[model samples]
Structures are given as structure tokens and as C-alpha cells.
Target: MASITLNKLVKRYGNGKTVNQVIHSVSAQIDDGEFVVVVGPSGCGKSTLLRMVAGLEEITGGEISIGNRVVNTLEPSERDIAMVFQNYALYPHMNVFDNMAYGLKIAKVPLVEIQARVDKAAKILELGEYMQRKPRELSGGQRQRVAMGRAIVRQPQAFLFDEPLSNLDAKLRAHTRLEIQKLHRELGITSLFVTHDQVEAMTLAQRMMVMNAGVMEQFGTPEEVYSRPATTFVASFIGSPPMNLLKNAPDARPGTIVGIRPEHLDITATGWALRVDALEMLGFERLVYGRWLHGAGNELVIVRSDETQPVPGLDTIIHVTPRADRLHTFDAATGKRL
Candidate 1:
């Protein structure tokens, strides 16, 4: 495993005035044996960034270093990185063992060494019994595991995943996530995973880079990103229900927006009056969507109430208090944390 570094990376399509710049000057240092997730919505340049690092996309400017070597001009095979894509990309005609060992075979590795490597990968991925099975016979999760096993056999300096779990069902995705976590724990390989799912990003990442519109909005641990979002875009995008940003909030300062998470608001007898618009039951907890009564614009606010709390009726007026310490302040014009 080796460290990966992106120094002022840039990517542009077309030339002259028609040039479309997708990736801005993004830079981040990924430590050796660390798992970093690059997460964002589609067309946000997250995949583009990953492809750049994988040497699949040409860099318009700046340098990409894998370990001690600068790999800007290197071919994808020469970069010593293994990429697991969204598609399984397995050979239907070949069995799991042959699929996993194909690259090593092409590289002219000894038959004994190829068998050893494929066996080790199959054992790691729990595919020992299905080594002779074709891709058509395997389940989706198993096929994904085969794809991963193929990469593992390469034993590259780093692993790059481009939405590898997107094709699976919810349960399979969750299960595969655990398998991936276990794989990382055992191998300790440097991994850069790209995904649009926030849950995947939060759960799998040692550190996550949140990107938007080709710009990296924030880069930090999941805890840091959730607890202290640097900008309004991040504040709104990172959470489940997302942080509520109210422009016309009570006791508001000029040109500032008050941001609060649903869970941080306490339903109280006296505070900000909220007229309940809707209520969503989520097993152990309920989400109360309401409009602030006092504000001129009647901005919407959501409050999370646990099973211990009473569920409020629709159109009923309920008071909720925002925790002073938990409130986030952002500059309304710039959408940046203040």
C-alpha cells in the first residue's frame, strides 16, 4: 500500500472558448493504507477526480503522485492501481479462478504464483467453493466480490472503486459494505472509493471529500463533516433530512442564516412556534415538518422526536427550541459557515 497525492489537479474538456472545465483545482493527500471516499452527487466531478487519479482521464494541470512516483503521464496499468468499477466487468466464458488470474497470466507470472495469488484472493473473498463457477451462475453480490477479488489478486499499490456497490439491492449493499470493511481491516490496502450515497460515504470512509459542481466543498472525517460543515451546500447535502437553513429565523442577524439539524431541536412549551404541516413515522422516531409561525416567510422546519415524545397532530401549533450550542450560522450571501 502507498500514499496518493493530488496536487492542484484540474481537468478540462474541449479547448479555447468552448472549453468546459469540470474539475477545479482540487488537492488532497491520501495516507498509506487509508480508505478515503470521494462523495458527491452525479456530475459533481467526483468520478472525474477518481478517474484522474486512476490515470484514465488526462489531467489538464498539476501533478498526481502515487507513493514516491509522479504518475501524471503514466498509463493506467503502469500506475500500480487496481480499479473496481460499477459494472462487474467479469468474463462470462471464464470461471472465477481464471477471471481472477487472467491479469497475472498475461503478465507472464509463474503458474504456481498465479494459483497462489488467486487462491489467496478467493479465500479472502470467501469464493473458494465457487472458483469454477461462471459469472452467469453467481449472484450480484458474489459477482461484485469476484470483481473485487480480481483487483485483490493484482496486489496493486492502491485500489480505486467507482460506485462498486450501486448495482446491489439495499440488503446486499449493506452486507457488501460489511464485507468491504472486513477486507480493508485484513489487507490494510490504500483505497479511494467514489460513491454518490452519503450513507456509504459516512460509514466506509476514514476521511471523505465532499464535492459539488467540480469543487471540493469539504475534506475531513465523517464526524468532522457532520458536526461542522464548512459551507451551506455541505450543511444541506451531508445529512439525511439535511440541515435546515432559515433565512427569516427569529432573532436573526443581518445577512446570516440560522442552520439547525432536526434532531437538535427540542419540542418545548415555549420557544419558536411551529405549525405542524406533516409528520413522518420512522419506527423508533418521528419527523415533524412544520412552518415557523413567527417568521414572515414562515420558513419550514423539521424536528425529530423519539418514541418517548408525543406525536403532534397536523396543523397544530407546537413550540420548538433550538439548542444554542448546536445552532450553525452561515453567511446568507455566500452560503459559507460563519
Candidate 2:
């Protein structure tokens, strides 16, 4: 395992007149054996950042160092890093064993050592039973495991995952997420995962970097980022139903907006009255969407509820209250946390 560091990293396209600067001056340190996730919406440059670290993309400025070596100029193969892409890039004609052992073989590792490494990786990935199966014969989850197994044998200094679970169904995605967590716990290799899924970031990362339109918004633990979001975009982006932005609130400062999460709201008899407009039943929990009474612009707010709790009917008026201390304040003009 090795520590991964990025200092003032930058990426741009074209040059001069048509130059489109994507990734800004981003910097962060990923400690040895730590799993860091870079997350954001599409077109946020999350993948671009990962590829930069992997040496697949050129860095227009700054530096990326894996362990003690500056890798900005190193070839992908020379960086001592392994990447698992979104699409399980396995050879359809190769059996599980060969696919996993192919890299080692190409590197000229002794056949005996390659066998040992493949066996160990297969066992760890629960792919021992499928070693003889080709990619076409295995399930989606199994194919993904083969991809992971291929990376595992490399035992690279770091692992780069670009939405490795994106191709799986919801249940398989959850299962693979647990498998990944277990793998990281056992291997404890430095890892960087990039994804647009907030839930994945929240569950898999020791510390996560939140990106927005080529800029680094916040870098912190899932708890820190979720509990005290660094920006309005984060407040709105990180949560399931997102935070309620009392845009143009009567009492808010001219350029600041008040933020409150769905789960932080309560139905009270004495608080602000909300007219229920919609309901989303999510098994054991429910989400109530309503607009504030006596407020203009149809500004909606969401309130999370337990299945056991009763919710108001649509168009019914119910009072909702926010935990004052949990309120987030952000600059409406700049979207930065205030």
C-alpha cells in the first residue's frame, strides 16, 4: 500500500482561444491503505481526476505522487497502479484463471508464481468455483469479480476504481459494495474510487472528495461532508431527497439561503404549516413533499418519516419544524457554505 498525493492538480482541453479548463487546482492527500472516493454528478471531472492519477490522462499542471514517486510523467503501466473500469473489461474468450493471470504473464512473472497469485486472488474473490468459466458463462456479478481479481493479482501500489459497480443491478450493486469493503479490509491497499453515487461514496470511503464542474468542493469523511456540507451544491447533492433551500426566504440575509435536510424536519402542531403535495413510500421510510403555507413561489420541502408514523394526506396542512442547530447557511449568490 502507498500514500497517494495530488497537489494543485489541473486539466485542460485545447489551448489558447478554445482552451476549456476542466479540473481546477485541486489538492488532497490519501494516506497509505486508505480508501478515498471522488464523487460528483456527470461532467464533474471525477473520472478525469482518477485517470490523471492513473497516468491515463495528462496533467496540465501540478503533480501526482504515488508513495514517494512523482507519477505525473510515468506511463500507466509504469505507475504501479491497477484500475478497474466501469465496464468489466474481461476477455470474453479467456477463462477466469487466464484473465486474472494474463497481466502477470505479460510482465514475465514465473508461471508458478502466477498460478499462486491467481489462486490467492480467486479464493479471496470467491471466484474459485468459476475459474474454469469463461466471461459469457458467469453472471454479471461474477464477471465483475474477475475484473477485480485481475487487479488484485497485480498487487499494485494503489487501486483505481472508476464506478466499478455501475453496471450491476441494484441488489448486486449492494452486494458488490460489501464485497469491496471486505476486500479493502483484508488487503488494506491504497484505493481511489470514482463515482456519481452518493450512497456508494458514503459507504465505501474513509474520506471522500466532492467535486463539482471540475472543481474540488470538499474533502472529508462521509460524516463530516454530510453533517456539515461545505457548500449549497453539496447540501443539495449529497442527500437522497436533498436539502430544502428556502430560497428568497423572508428572514434570510439578502445573499444567503437556509438549508435543511429532509430527515432533520419534524411534524409539529406549532411550527410552520406545510400543505402536503406528494408522498413517496420507501419500504420502512416515507418522504413527504409539501409547500410552505403563506409562502410564495411554491417552494417545496421534504420531511422524512418512519413507516410506523402516520403522514398527512395530499393537500392536507401539517406543521413542519426544522432543527435550528442543524440548519445550514450558504451564500445564495456563490453557493458556498456561509
Candidate 3:
């Protein structure tokens, strides 16, 4: 139950002549019991920052604290933290119960206390029925849960997860996400998760950090990041199929890019007309793609609708309209929201 703080964190490799800055001057405060996900594209340094906090990576500069203690110089074992890696890392020969109790054994916790903690964790993770099962006997999702249970039995001040669900199938990943959320609520331990999946970040985070090329793009609730993205990269990266970033003229007022989400589009009877290019009928919803009018060029604009309207033939005319708020403007030079 500790709040984590980062102050001007910096990670650089090589000397000043060729410094490869993996993390810039990063600073953030994660409240106690907060479930914060750090999300970014590959090579953006989200995992680097998480590793620094875990003491797995050295911080070139700045301060990191857990509760009121500065832990930058502490070894991973001394940080009062538990980490659940992407790989389950379970011992092949160890049974679930043994795996969960191993940490306590290493710390010389009394046998009875270890049993009580392991048993409690097993119940929480629904592993009571599989306590005797070895890693080979369990499914991928089960192994992931076992990794989580191992961390839980420690009752550490915080938990760090690095793409914990990357290996699971879609359904199992979704189920496990819910389980993790529930576990967070039950344990109330401070947690930091790192992932590239926007869906996972959106669903699992109470607050989140969006990182880009080692710099934090945004830090706020999922709603704030989604509804009011601070930059064009964030606007495009946070949503499915991403926000449409249409290029406008250099003299295009204050906004060089016009953004619109597919769901916010309207199938208007009269508006900027276009020729139907393609359609995707997805049971409950449909995506319509068409060429924009006003010499808007050969590129396509996408719109989503719930009603399976007439599937227009290729090149057939279709008009589009969008809600005013759904339309976004971004500065051309910096690609920042306007």
C-alpha cells in the first residue's frame, strides 16, 4: 500500500557525444492502490520506465520513491515489490501450491504462515482445485494466473506487470483482465502495468500513461486520454482503426489535420458526397468507406453505423456528416491538438 513517485527520471546510454536517451525527464505520481497502465508503440520505452521502477534497469538521472523511501539504489529484492513478467516463469516440476509457497520459503516465513498465505491466494485465484497440478498440466491462462497468485501470496507494497496477457487468446485475455481488475480491488496494492494494446490499457487502467519515444504523451484517466487526446499521435493510437487524420491545406486555419472517429460519423441524406469504396458488415455495426467530395482526393474516409443500410455498389454516391464535437483539429507543425 504505497504511492510511487518519479521525479525527472532519465535513462541514457553512451557518452554525451552519442547519448541514446531511452527516457527523458519523466515525472509522475501514482497514488496508493491506483492501477496505472503505461502504453505505447514498440520501442517507445514504456517497459524501460517500468524496469527502472523495478530496479531491473538503471536510472541515469532523477529520483524514484516507493512510499517515502528513495529506492533508486535498492536491489529489486529490496524494493518491497513483486513483478509478474510476461512469461509465466513457473518451475516445470513445482506444483501450484509449491510454486506459490516458494517465495515465503526463501524469506524463511514460518511454515504455517506460508500455508495460510498460499491457501488464501489459491482461493483468490481459483487455484484451489489445481493446487497439485504442475505447470505442464495447466493451460496458458492457468499458468498466468499461477504467476499472479505467486505475487499475491507475498502481499508486497506494489505489483508490476509487463504485458502479462500478451500470450493468451482474445477470450482468455479478456477474462484475465477482469480477474486482474477484481484482484486489484480486493488487494488494493499499488500497480503499474505496461502494454501496447490500447484495448487492454483502456479497460484495465484507472489512470494511464501514454508514452511515445520515451516521452510521456499523456497521463490521465482513460476517458481523458480517449475523448481529449493532447496530440495527433495519441488521437490516432488510442482508438480501434484509430482516428482519421485528414490532411488539410497549409492555410487551413489553425488546424492542419482534421480528425474524426468512425463511430462519430453520420450517414446524412445531404452533405459532402462521396463514392462508396468498401463496406464491412459486423453484425451489430457496419463500417462504410468512401471517397470524399470537394476534390478531397483519392484517399478514403470511414464511417460506422449500426443499421445495415443498403450496401451501395462501388462508385455509388454516399454522403457523410459528423457530430461537431467529434471533429478535431490538430496543428500541422507539431501534430498537437488545437
Candidate 4:
């Protein structure tokens, strides 16, 4: 296993006056055997950042180190990292065993050692029964497993995953996520996974890097990012229904905005008055969309209520109070936590 480090990494396209910068000066240290996920919305340069670490994209400026060596100029093969792409890039004509063993064979590893490695990887991935099956004979999940097994057989210093679960069905994606967690625990290889799914980042990361428009907004554990976001973008992007940012909240300080999560607002007999606009039933809980009737008079707010709570009628005025300890204050102009 190896640690990966990025020092003020930058990526730009074109040149001179037309240079379009895609990645700003981003830097982070990924400790050995740690699973770090890069997550953001589409076109946010998360994938581009991952590709740079994998030695696929040229770094416009800055340094990338894998283990103890500077790998900025190393080719993909020379970097000693295994990459698992979204599409299962398996050989259609080769059976599972041959496909997994091909890399070692090409490297001139002893035949016996290659067999042992392939066999061990297959057992770990639970693909022993399908060792002789061609790619056409396996399901999508199975094929993906074969791809992972192929990477495992090489025993590289680190692993890179580029949305490896994007093609899987929802149920299969959940199952594969568990398998990946187990794989990391057992092998303890350093890994960097890139994805747009916040749930994946929240569940799988030992630490996560949240990116926006090529700039890294925050790098911390899921709890820290969710509980105390650094900026308004992180606050609004990390949550499900998102935190409410009210510039004109009744009790908000001047020149500051108030942020409250949906679950932090409580329905009360008397408090801030809100006119109910809509209510959504989500199995175990409900989300109430309402318009605040004070301050700016039209600020929208969302409140999460459990199934036990009585549903408020639409257009009816209801009172709610934000938890004193749960309220977050941010600078109105910068959208940054104050």
C-alpha cells in the first residue's frame, strides 16, 4: 500500500489568453491504505482530478506523488496502480481465469505464481465458479467483479475507481458497495474513488473531498462535512433536501444568513409563521414545503416531520421554531459560515 499526495494541482486547457482552467490549485494528502472519495456534481472536474492521479491527464502545474516517488511524468503502467473503470473492460473471448491472469502473464511472471494469484483473487471475489465462463455468459455485476478481480491479481500499490458502479442497477450497486468495503478491509490497499453520488461518498469514504467547478471546497470525514460545512455550496450540496439558507430570516443577524436543516425545525403552537405550500410523504417521514410569512415574506423553507406528526393542510398558516442549538449562521455576501 502507498499514500497519495497532491500538491497545488492545476489543470488548464488551451494556452496564453485562451487558457481555460478546469482544476484550481487543489491539494490533499491521502494516507496509506485510506479510502478517499472525490465527490461532486457532473462537470465539476472530479473525474478529471482522478484521471490526473492515475497518470492519464497531464498536470498543468503542481506535483503528484504516489508512495515516495514523484509520478507526474510517469506513464500509467509505470505508476504501479490498478484502475477499475465504470465499464467492465473484460476480454470477451477470454474466460475469467485467463482474463485475470493476462496481466501477470504479459509481465512474464512464473506460470505457477500466476495461477495462484488468479485463483486467490477469484476466491476473494467469489468468482471461483465462473472461472471458465466467458464475458458473454456472465451478468453485469459478475462482469464487474471480474474486472475488480483482474485489478486485485496485480497487487498494485493503490487502486483507482472511476464510477465503477454507475452502470449497475440500484440494488446491485448497493450490493457491490458492500463487497468493495469488504475487499478494502481484507486487502487494505490505498484507494481513490470518484463519483457524483453523495450517498456513496458518505457511506464509503474514510474521508471525502468535495469539489465544485474544479476547486476543492472541503476535505474531511462525512460527519464533519455534513455537520459543519465550510461554505454555503458545501452546506447546500451535501444534504438530501439541502439546508435552508435564509437571508431574510426573522431572527437572522443583519448581513448574515441563517441555515437550518429540515429535521431541525419543529412545529409549534406559536413561533415563526409559515404558509404550507406542499407536503411529500416519503414512507417513514414527510417533508413540508412552506413559505415564511415574516421578514422577506416569501422565503421558502423545508421541514421534515415523522409519520406520527399530524399533516398540516395546504395554504394553512402554521408555526415552527428552529432549534436554538441547531441553527447555523453564515455571511450573507460570501455564503461562508460565520
Best by lDDT: 1
Q: Quantify all predictions' global Cα lDDT against the true fold.
A: 0.94, 0.92, 0.89, 0.93
Residue lDDT tens for model 4, 1-338: 89999999999999989999999999999999999999999989999999999998999999999999999999987898998988978999999999999888988999999999999999999999999999999999999999999899999999999999999999999999999999999999999999999999999999999999999999999999998888888889998899998887788889998999999999999987899999999989899999978656778999999988899999999899999888889998887788
Q: List the residue pairs that clash in candidate 1.
A: none
lDDT of candidate 2 over 1-338, digit per residue (tens): 79999999999999989999999999999999999999999999999999999898999999999999999999998999999989988988999999999989989999999999999998898899899999999999999999999999999999999999999999999999999999999999999999999999999999999999999999999999999999987888898889888885445787789998999888888687778999999898899998877748489888998877786899999887788888889988888888
Enumerate residue pairs that collide in model 4.
none
TM-scores for all candidates: the values are 0.98, 0.95, 0.94, 0.97
Error of model 4, residue 332, in angstroms: 2.4
Could you arrange the candidates by TM-score from highest to lowest?
Answer: 1, 4, 2, 3
lDDT of 1 at 31: 99
Evaluation by TM-score, superior candidate among 2 and 4: 4
How displaced is residue 77 in candidate 4, in Å?
1.1
lDDT tens digits, residue span 1-338, model 1 = 79999999999999989999999999999999999999999999999999999998999998999999999999998999998989989999999999999989988989999999999999888999999999999999999999999999999999999999999999999999988999999899999999999999999999999999999999999999998999999999999899999887887798999999999999999998889999999998899999977747467898998999988999999999999998999999988999
Q: Using alpha carbons, what is the TM-score of model 4?
A: 0.97
Off by over 4 Å in 1: none
Model 4, which residues run further than 4 Å from truth? none
User: How close is each model in CA RMSD to the real structure?
Assistant: 1.1, 1.6, 2.0, 1.3
Candidate 3 Cα RMSD after full superposition onto the native fold (Å): 2.0
Query: Relative to the unseen true structure, what is the C-alpha lDDT of residue 212 in candidate 2, on a scale of 0 to 100?
Result: 96
Supply the global lDDT for candidate 4.
0.93
